[model samples]
Target chain A: MAAFALGWLALWELAARAGWISRLFFPPPTTILLTLGRMLVTGNLAPALALTLYRLALGVAIGAGSGALLGWLMGSSRSVRLALDPIVTALHPLPKLAIFPIFLVLLGIGEASKVALVALTAFFPMVINTLAGVQQIDTTHWEAAANYGARGRALLQRIILPGSLPLVLVGLRLAVNGALMVTIAVEMLSAREGLGALIWLAWQTLRTEELYAVLLVIGVLGLASNSLLELTSQRLLPWKGET
Target chain B: MQITYRIAKYLKVVLAVLLLAACTPIGEPATPTPAPVLVRVGVLPFMSNAILKIADAEGFFVEQGLTVELVPFRSSNDFVPLLLQGELDVAAPALTAGFFNAIARGGNVKIALPLTAFTPQDCPVVVVLARKSDVEAGKYASPAQWKGATIGISLAGAQGLPGYVVDLFLRQAGLTAQDVTLTALDPAVQGEALRSQQVDLLYAAEPWITRLLAGDDVVVLSRAEDVAPDLTSSFMVYGPSLLAEPEVGRRFATAYLNAVRQYHEGKTPRNVELVAEYAGLETELVQQVCWSDIPLDGAVNVDSIMLYQEWLHDLGLLDRLLSADEFLATGFVEVPE
Candidate 1:
């Protein structure tokens, strides 16, 4: 990973230096770094960066938590699964961005709409993964827990949950990335602040350098958040990392 | 066990804090060290040799201590917001709609030079081209029959520019926009649409018109000049900021006008190559597109601005009706001593 990043940086700088490519069209990696440093010196990153991560966390958490619970219920109840599967399948193909206008119109283009859009983008993967996880979670595990006097909530916590957690984590990673994508997308559509808006406003004014600067900031923030989430999943399921 | 809960609790708290913090104020980028006094100049493919080649080559802008740049756009909308925001210094922008949108949006851009002076009998720059079939069917067989039908003007930003009203000679042939679908095809895609019969009428300016005329299948339905005997289609404009920096504004205008003069006189093969480079066209194609749309002598016509104000108002684009004076941007060329 380090080598890939370093090699890309070297190539970018060399191209700009050699005059093989116009720096105006694609600025040097160092120029981006210099701009990023200036942004940091000015303390421009923290607020928007924090907001993006926060939205990702909230969206993924809600999507994962709800999807897991609902998936388990559907797995246990055949009737419930039958009713929801068609509905889920029916709505799955709609373009998430195309529906943003509906959200904006209904939700009035606030944080509520942005959060909802992020959640909407995230919820699908979590639900689908959790469903698969729950179906494949052994039936014997629940029976064994009940036989040991673990009932209801105790059965869920002692047996069903741990069995399904690995799949839920897969669902969670997907949701986390989805949440990040939707968060930026919502902001781009219409927001007074955030990295997407920053890129967009710069584009409107033909500030290509400033636009690239904002894009670089968003990329770093996204990578950092995803790395943090990966580290979290490793701690939550230590054996998975070893495997 | 306590540490695990504590970590989760702190994580939740941090997450919530981050989300809540998003509600606060953001600092805008402080004015960076002034860039190389970059002036964003909009250039069309037609002016590639006349305007763009000079700016790109010949070091003309360096003399003015300005870095003249071209924002080659297929439509005026791309330039409109930047021009309004004081991002662009000069735009050899296309005339849109009945109203001057750039000046209306609080941008201080004015006519830097008059391109294509108006004459009563001269062919206007903006015109409606229809299939000879549509024109002869009492459909505008020629520029004379363009009224009362919806004509296709390529690009969304152009639709609002009143190309329909201006070139059709304000004849109001009873054709509402609904009568003809003003399909929003980009000019590059126009040939396909024309071949497909998707658009019955097309509003094209010179060069595109001249190029289409080159083909035997497409006939000159109308010269934009035939429709309106006034309001020449081409113009150069600079907003207040650039104009206020008289030294900067004059240099760009002078270099640009010099380039225009160069093309009118004729370009060297090298100069032709430079224009073609930016135009993304071959020399033969560039020659076809460059025969006209000349950088003629005249200033921004008051009549054109008035036409825009009046027509855009009728189109319900403006809240308060503005007169020609309200739209005219000043500080262009000084009057004779």
Candidate 2:
């Protein structure tokens, strides 16, 4: 896969060098890499990356924590499910960006608004996935837990949580990815820092090479995060076998 | 199966109708009429772009043998890319670091005409507003008081006209950019930000200036005109499509300047009506907001543009400092001696 990626980049570089593509719009990979290196050396990339990651971490934690708790409740109690399902169904399809202005108004145009937007974007996938995770657990497992005298917290800790672990991981992965995306988007709209702001600045200043470099950084960050999540899931769920 | 069958039957009927419509032909005229050259002009619903609307409404484009298509855009970011890509024949956006940067990077777009400027007679097209509460509390009373205060602008990087104006305001008081934090806020929410005390000062343009001034929330700190008199704010840019055909560009300019003459005729009833109709503002609001000056002969201030380029370059927002000749496509319209 690495070789294939290198070959693809080589073709792109060749095309740009050969003038098949407009260099002003699509700089060669080498140019992008060099630009990225310059940004890093010049101490521009690190802070932006760090801020974006920080926002993503905080947003995903808040969103996923609340979403999992509510999802578990919804799955455990039919009354909860019926009440929230309509609200969730109505809201899940609405774009998070549509409500960003409201967040800015409520939270003010600061870090709070950006973080809130990211959290909202991360919330839906986590809730939906976690709800499915809890519902899909076998009823026999619950009965078995009860037979073993497991109740309330004990039942939750030993049976429900462990049984629902796999889908919960899936939910977490989705939330993290969504959180990152929203972080970049909100930052682009109204921020002076982060990869999104860098991208916006590059765009505003017509620094196409710099824009491409920031985009590459974002892509790598996404890939690295997903890999880390996958490795973590494997370690947490060894019994699931090769997942 | 029944649903699929019904869908297929409906599709067949639709296709039959389409085929019938396609086969039907209208006879051509005996004399072949020359097609008017189509120019796709991108515009934002701002007072600055009143000339494009005036030109269209007054049939100036028709007189020039051009078919003008006014494409509305939300922001320069939206239309700049399109203009670069040749999707838009012309665009009139504020003179920004981005536009200069594009030209430096070999984007086949050139400043065709001066769109708007700050003149003595006109109200300030852009202004710096301080929070009313802050002003009442004896804060931001003068430029010296702006030290360590947060100023909200529509764009960051200090690369645009507002940034230059702010810098001018700062320098007059021996203050610099480091003394105050310049935060970028959307123009739509700038009033709210100031009202909520998110930022101590706002660099705003009309009709936002008019609307914000309506309430007692913000007090005018400085007018851009007072700071930088005769400063050019925006320009009409010609993309590759228009640039490739000099005659078409010249014709467009001719019509545009004709409209500029009408615009300079002041707020006539017809002019106000056209501006209101084009800008999607009420006639009263149209009359209320301050308008920028467009040169009667459409002559650009070359020195002013060069000064802006130097400022951006000095600020490190622009990598290449462009010469006036490199970006300005002159001789499209007559410049006064």
Candidate 3:
């Protein structure tokens, strides 16, 4: 995979250098990497990256925690499920960025509004996925756990949690990715600093190399996070087997 | 045998059709009527762009053998790339560091005519306004008082005309942008920001300025003209397509300057009506707000533009400074005697 990636980059660099594509719009990879390095050396990239990660972390924590709790309740109780299902169905498909103005107005055009937008966007995927996870837990596990005299918290801890671990991990992964996306978008709309704001400024100034550099940073961030989640899932669910 | 006969019959019919088509007279020869040169103009719905509308409405473009299509755009950030790519033939975008940077980076666009500027006698179209409560409490009565204040502007960073105006306004009090915080807010919502005290000062222009003043909650701190007399703010630019066709560019400029003459006629019923129609406002509202000044001769202020470039370069906003000859395309139109 690494060799294939290098070959692809080499082809892109050659095309850019040979004038097969516009260097202004699609800057060569070496140019972008050099720009990225310069920005880091100048202390421009770190703060923005740190702030983006900070927003992503907080938003994911709040969104995923609430979503998982709500999903568990909705899955365990038919009344809760019926009550929330309609609201979720109605709102889950909403384009989160479309309602960013409402969040800005409500939370006052500061960090709170950006964080709230990220959390709201991160919430739906988590809730839907975790609910599916909880619902798919085998009924036999519940009946057997209860037969062993387990009740309430014991039955939840010993059976429901163990049974739903895999899908819960899936929900968490989705929530994190969604949170990162929303955080970047909100930052682009209103923030003074962040990877998204950097990209926006670069485009505004017609600095294509800087734009590509920031995009490369964002792409790497997404890949690293997804890989971490995948590793965590593998470690946590070894008994589910390689398949 | 049947298939061979069928193929022979089809070939005969095809040959006959081809021979008839070859012998047909396409049309009678006559004097050619040249189609009007279509020019795609990107414009924002602002009074500053009234000349383009006036030119179209008053038949100046038709007289020049040109067809002008006005494309409405929301922001320079949206249309500038199109302009650079030659998708837009003409646009009147505000002077910005990004524009200079784009030009320095080999963008095939050039300033063709002057559009709007700050003249001493004109109504103050652009002004700095402070919250009424702050002004009354003596918090921001003068430029020196601007220290530590959060000011709202329409564009991000110190890269555009607003930033230059703000810098000039600050220099009067022997202060710079470092003494104040600049916040990027949409012009439509700037009044709300000032009213809600989200920002202490607002660098804004007409319509918004008129509406905000009518509410009695914001007071004009300073007019932009008072600080930088005759500073050019915006100009008409021609993309590569228009530049390549010098005749078309000349005709477009001719029509544009003729419209400028009409624009200077000042609040005629016809002018007001046309401006209202193009700007999407009521005639009364159009008459109420201050209009921007476009020179009758359509000559840009080169020194003022150079000063803007130098200031932006000092702020490290521009990648490199562009020479007047590099960005300005001359000889498109003659200066009035």
The model with the greater TM-score, 2 or 3, is 2
Q: Output the worst ten-in-a-row residue range by lDDT, candidate 1 chain A.
A: A200-209
What C-alpha root-mean-square deviation, in Å, does candidate 1 show against the real structure?
Answer: 24.0
- The lDDT leader among the candidates is 2
- The CAPRI category of model 3 is acceptable
Query: Which regions of candidate 2 deviate over 4 angstroms?
Result: A1-3, B1-34
Point out the worst 10-residue segment of candidate 3 chain B by lDDT: B152-161
Candidate 1 TM-score, C-alpha based = 0.49
TM-score of 2: 0.91
Using TM-score, give the best candidate's number: 2
Taken over the whole model, the C-alpha lDDT of each candidate is: 0.62, 0.86, 0.85
Per-candidate DockQ values are 0.01, 0.37, 0.24
Question: How far off is residue A201 in model 1, in Å?
Answer: 18
Chain B TM (all candidates):
0.70, 0.86, 0.87
Q: State which docking tier applies to candidate 2.
A: acceptable
